[model samples]
Target chain A: MNADPTRLLAREMAARLRTGETTARALAEAHLDAAERQNHALNAWLVIDRDGALRQADAADAVLAGARRDGPGALAALHPLLGIPVGLKDLISVEGGQCTAGSRILEGYRAPYDAHIVERLRDVGAVFLGKTNMDEFAMGSSNEYSAFGPVSNPWDLDTVPGGSSGGSAAAVAAHHVPLSLGTDTGGSIRQPASLCGIVGMKPTYGRVSRYGIVAFASSLDQIGPFARDARDAAALLHAVAGRDARDSTSAPVPVEDELLHLPESDDEAVAWLRGRRFGLPREYFVAGMDPDVERRIHESVAFLVDAGATVEDVSLPHTDYGLATYYIVAPAEASANLARYDGVRYGLSRRLEGGDFIADYLATRGEGFGAEVKRRVMLGTYALSAGYYDAFYVKAQKVRTLIKRDFDEVFASGIDALVAPTSASVAFRFGARMTDPVSMYLSDACTLPVNMAGLPGVSIPCGLSEGMPVGLQLIGPAWSELMLFRAARAFEGLTAAATWRNLEPAQLAEADDAAGPTPAERAAALAAAR
Target chain B: MAGLSRSDVEHVAHLARLGMTTAELDRLEGQLNHILEQYMKLAELDTDAIPPTAQTIELENILRDDVATPSLPASAVLGNAPAREGDFVIVPPILGGDAG
Candidate 1:
């Protein structure tokens, strides 16, 4: 098996395979081998399907051969991602495999059926390589909350790769897999992608189906993708997108593949960015941002300006309250979503023979969760509890509305999209801010507002900061994924040659010993740590 | 606001169903209370007439039809269970192994 084909976009890989430059089976084998080599160091994959992937790759080859001889549409036509290897975040259910959600509570649990998106991916011939790790039950800002151990940044082993989609980001960044799916409730996808220096997109809330995804905060959780670049992310959004009866909230719109074959005409491209206004929300330039990060983001603004996109200072006055409101409302909903995990119906049943059923419930949950998960559950329960509801939970909801209104007002002012630093700073080394939950939560300050307002957002590799990657987040109004894609692609086109040239991962044995254990040892430590 | 009593910590742990040692409990109590206090600032704002917005976007009745869909066989769904008894999921006994 060969290492993963690096820097090549997924669509390009598929096109090459279709054009007979490479075989699907060979590509799949290469990716699987890469995933295996990288998995031991990054702790990215939860499973590796050596046999299953080969079978699918062979099948894809057979179909493509037939299609070539028959000349287009002679064989069953599938999406361009057909038979391409992809990774799934463990939190979502896939029919036969385990859906751990990075928790010991569901250690060996499997789903009865595939998630809506999983099924769609299958329809298009995407191969499921394995599940990726996440913050336990999608509850934390850092992947450290996972019972599976923390996912390390591939670019710099000592630093965190963001979460709760940290593993997805790491897998793609390390070139283990070109594309992987992740979910974003509140910056889960974008933050990790930013930290890891890759592209991650959270489609408008309902753009992708959430039918088989385990609930965290149902209203906010939207399944998205992490990829090497914006084009691949857009390709994934095209492949597994649109309405499904399985997910009631999946948007009821016709699926569009137009995003995949974007016109190369500069006039058409510039028109999309220039005719469209870009908003720079004044509030996201928070007080504690690293100066290097601010400098890099300013460079990103300059890059966009060079691409013919105009930027104007805009106001989202309610942005200051996004974090507080998200924590309150998400946890309150989480309390409801997680209520089903009691001992009786599913997961880690504890029987207290002499005690009452209530006692049994208490004992079971007591042993099931981690500290951060429990703390949030308690805070959520308290917020939604009697008497406290009006003050905490209800007020938070009102503030959420005002936050959404803030986005509406800015978009109403003719802004095509908004751009900002994806995080306050570049990746932090392990244990740097783990003990401080407030500081950990603050890392998501810039990315959280998009999720709060139920909008589409993408994180693209901007410039570097102190020799680490920084991302410029591009946010668009609901269902404006295409617009966001165009804006990002334009910026990417200009700065593509620069940035990320210095991001060579020092091999496990050679990495600074102060960074912690060797990559392989860290991988095992993460598994055992879980 | 940053300080939390041992009993309060125990109570919260009870609700969350996480067992904690004395040191861990003490640490968490102080940390949780400090975090909670930061959230208390929302009380200063007046939102009397504003209706609570549970979803950022006002997408009402966005439910799919209650239709039966294709499902994997029962064997696949239960393939990874740590323990199972017949068609039912089996979990560790809270009191004793024989309880299940």
Candidate 2:
């Protein structure tokens, strides 16, 4: 109770709730207050549902009251996430709430029903703070591609929080929420988590059902969690991951209870790392990696080595091809998934009085989609066009097989997980990589291969680079989320006493300034200055 | 690995049902070509014998009981429609009309 509730971890808040030291309503109010007060500068949330969150919080309080009246067993049976405030990426549908997917096309589209994850979270009594901002249709690497505006990294007011789950990362990083949900197609979750300095994991493909959530790349997209630590991230992942009959792709794998019971003791957690073999992908340390970022990753790896883990240089030879392969594969799936955005059905509509349906479609789509979305749709269409299907789409898929094989071979060699830098560099300033799309795409170089291989990957803060946070990523084979979380928790245990681990995001105070320029204003000023 | 020309960009945009301005098309032509150049790296690997991986997780033919479930209310579904007439959504003429 002495510490600020907003700054405390969700699990800590849950513990407080269990002991009657704090109420769920008090926790929800603390986060909502911070989120609303700082939103002008951070722009992390598109909506902050004060009323809805309070309602959920009150319901949680009632449940706690009932459990208290009963017995210790009933109280202990409560979900750890009950009463936790969670910010959902805009694409995750909450029934009757706007599901923009960060696109003008979906500007006013209220989801008719809750997404599967939303239903799951609601069932566990997790309070929904509101929808967070994101790249339009989850296409861009920088949150700048969001049609609404960019999300600022709480570490630095002018820098990006990474994307397209930027808002979720920023929200958690800025302490607006202790946990949030984000989807990863090609490093959307991990890269932003890296940029914002939090724990993020992209569960193995189909580990989490996608029914009712907006689609980007069908084969690659997977929902995951963002938390300040690995255990909380694991708990969030446990809440929503598993089979859903609606989404045929949702794997029927058993959700692990071990996820809920990650070792809490520092000594016990560190022991899990002993004798575990970690592979450092040689291709991940590419030419343009920032020196500070590289140093942090190496230091983290050395720490693992010192802790009795064997670190070996391994090659995911097809890593260089990940960028190109992902560009093609994701955009192709995006184009197909986005075709439902025609004017008449739902979302933004443009109808020329005498114009035909094709014209209506053209006008609606052209005007509705943002620059990055349009570019992706164009690339996808051309790739799938006549005389080019084999040369492009099919070719990309074949190379995807090679990418997956690279991970398979390394894991087959007794490597428990691959350790690497989550992002090649720390968070960059807004408009830094905006002009050149390829440069922006390169932001995800180190992490995208995991998505290509359908593996579970976690990005946890290792240390700081140039006064900003840097992430150390751990990737494991498909359905190895439990192993990855264990490794991440072990790394957290090892780094618990480190100076950088004790530091909060630097610019949060500045983000609380009510008179400061909004993220949109800052972006416009940057553009005008350029 | 051929670069997308201005015409190719325009044609593809049309096929994708996007009405683009000349300036947008001009920028896209160059950008699309540059991105394609990145895809050119995939050619470095001869994947002739490698089977394409369309889906990664190997989940096949997921089936469930055929029993019908209650669907979303028509009113709820229609609430988002831009133009709706009673139970149906209105659309621009698609057949037997001048292609404007």
Candidate 3:
């Protein structure tokens, strides 16, 4: 809202780069310097490509100069993020780059080819700032389970930033990179983004290519942008979004130019109920939800109502089944996906002699995986075990259908989108959920249902409680990303509070230096730390 | 159904791979059982008529047209392998006796 160049969004930053106010090389060098200085405190980046980045930035400058001589090159070259710095979650592959997925098993594993999204970003001249930390294999909600080490909250070091996309959120929040991509399966992106107080989008399933993103839950993983705001996120989406031949599940549609010449709105949000409808799913307001969070949701709804959107109480009785269903389905996929990590072909190989082939498989996997990853693999293996398959895994799948149907019913009933608190409460302290696995899983309650239903969801800064950020989630029907973006933008516009905007480095330093045992090195650090 | 036996815990540990002490296994068994029990909530729902959903988006014919695209050079593909033998990406042998 202010005219300050320092706080300008990424889109504005890119515009200045294109206008030659600052060269792409200068912006890259400055951000790289900032990242290097802050990395000791933040621990957000797994690798910062000082040499590779400068080379890429120099290339972008050359491209921009040539484009000036001619016109902005083709759509591939004229892309908005052409020279912007992007930190990718290690889960996504970038050819010739180390893609560890924040795991010891994947350590030193360089991809032979770029992921479809990586290819797009490279074609547009995006400077890759290497990989950010994530929950190993994208299994956890908080980023505490990374093999690289826990990424501290940019706001308060005592607290978590949020996981499995915690590093991406923290990097963007701390201004290390203006844009980063993270995969969300069961609130991985949105929850961390919410906790970190930045913008995150989990596009409708298949909206973004998942070809080279390391599988956690194949069915649920969708890579989306984490940016300063919705408009910049929309622009990043335009550059990297769309179908890819590598990802069969990618949507067969053209990327949306949704942010072009977008009109500015002064009013935060006027919840116009004239013809638009918003549903408040009762199941989202569970017992353990913080009272402060409930209050913020109420305020957000009021702001939406003032912005002219109609609000009504709705029932998603099947919502209670989501956590159970997610655990089963996600683990089942995790089991199948992680089977490739046997030390034979790739990953860590332990030495043994005269052992049975199966024994070697057992030994290699046992040593390669961390405790949490093993737990999920075991759960998945058990669920898909022959005798129990019909009972557990099959049953979970059936429940998943019901969850999707619940959303469908509401959308069909005239509601353009549904709104709920992104998480039941604000972020907890670093070790709050460490020993409580069930309670930890339950934190995804408000966010998981959207992924189950394959709907587009955006978590925008709605309000704050107890000095931490709380996000209001807006969910739209399949392929209705535009509507979700529009609604979220409107709500984001209406909320004049800068409560969830940025995190200062002082907060990170305080959290890291405070008296405490050194945080878990890697395995525990992978889960998002929100 | 109940807390894991020492042998069962050992088996899982063997399957997962970090060397754990007996105390660590005992603690893990307790935590894993508690989690497995909580997840049993899926067993309560009657999903008899519902269809299993592997993917939420409804898209048809996900196959791409068969086209011969340019391939990565063999050098780049095997370049980063920690252990490589000639044209092959060498690995620490699966049978794992010693350097092969």
DockQ list for all candidates: 0.36, 0.82, 0.43
Which digits, one per residue and each the tens of the lDDT, describe model 3 over residues A296-343? 899889877776678999998889989888888888898888888766
Off by over 4 Å in 3: A1-6, A71-77, A267-274, A497-530, B1-24, B79-84, B89-100
lDDT of each: 0.78, 0.93, 0.77
Residues A159-254, model 1: lDDT tens digits: 778898888888887776789999998899999988888889999988898888988987789989898777788889988888776576777766
Candidate 1 CAPRI category: acceptable
Clashing pairs for model 2 are none
Model 2: per-residue lDDT, tens digit, A1-530?
A: 45689989999999999999899999999999999999999999999999999999999999999999998899899999999999999999999999999999999899999999999999999999999999999988889999988998999888899998999999999999999999999999999999999999999999999998999989899999999999999999999999998899999999999999999999999998889999999999999899899999999999999999999999999999999999999898889989999988899999997757888999999999999999999888888888999999999999999999999999999999999999999999889898899999999999888999899999999999878999999999999999999999999999999999978899989998999998888877887888
Highest lDDT model number: 2
- Give the DockQ of candidate 3: 0.43
TM-score of each: 0.91, 0.99, 0.91
User: Which portions of model 2 show Cα errors greater than 4 Å?
Assistant: A528-530, B98-100
The 10-residue segment of model 1 chain A with minimum total lDDT is: A506-515
- Candidate 1, residue A446: CA error in Å? 0.9
Candidates 1 and 3 compared: the better one by DockQ is 3
- Residue A198 shift from truth in candidate 3, angstroms: 0.7
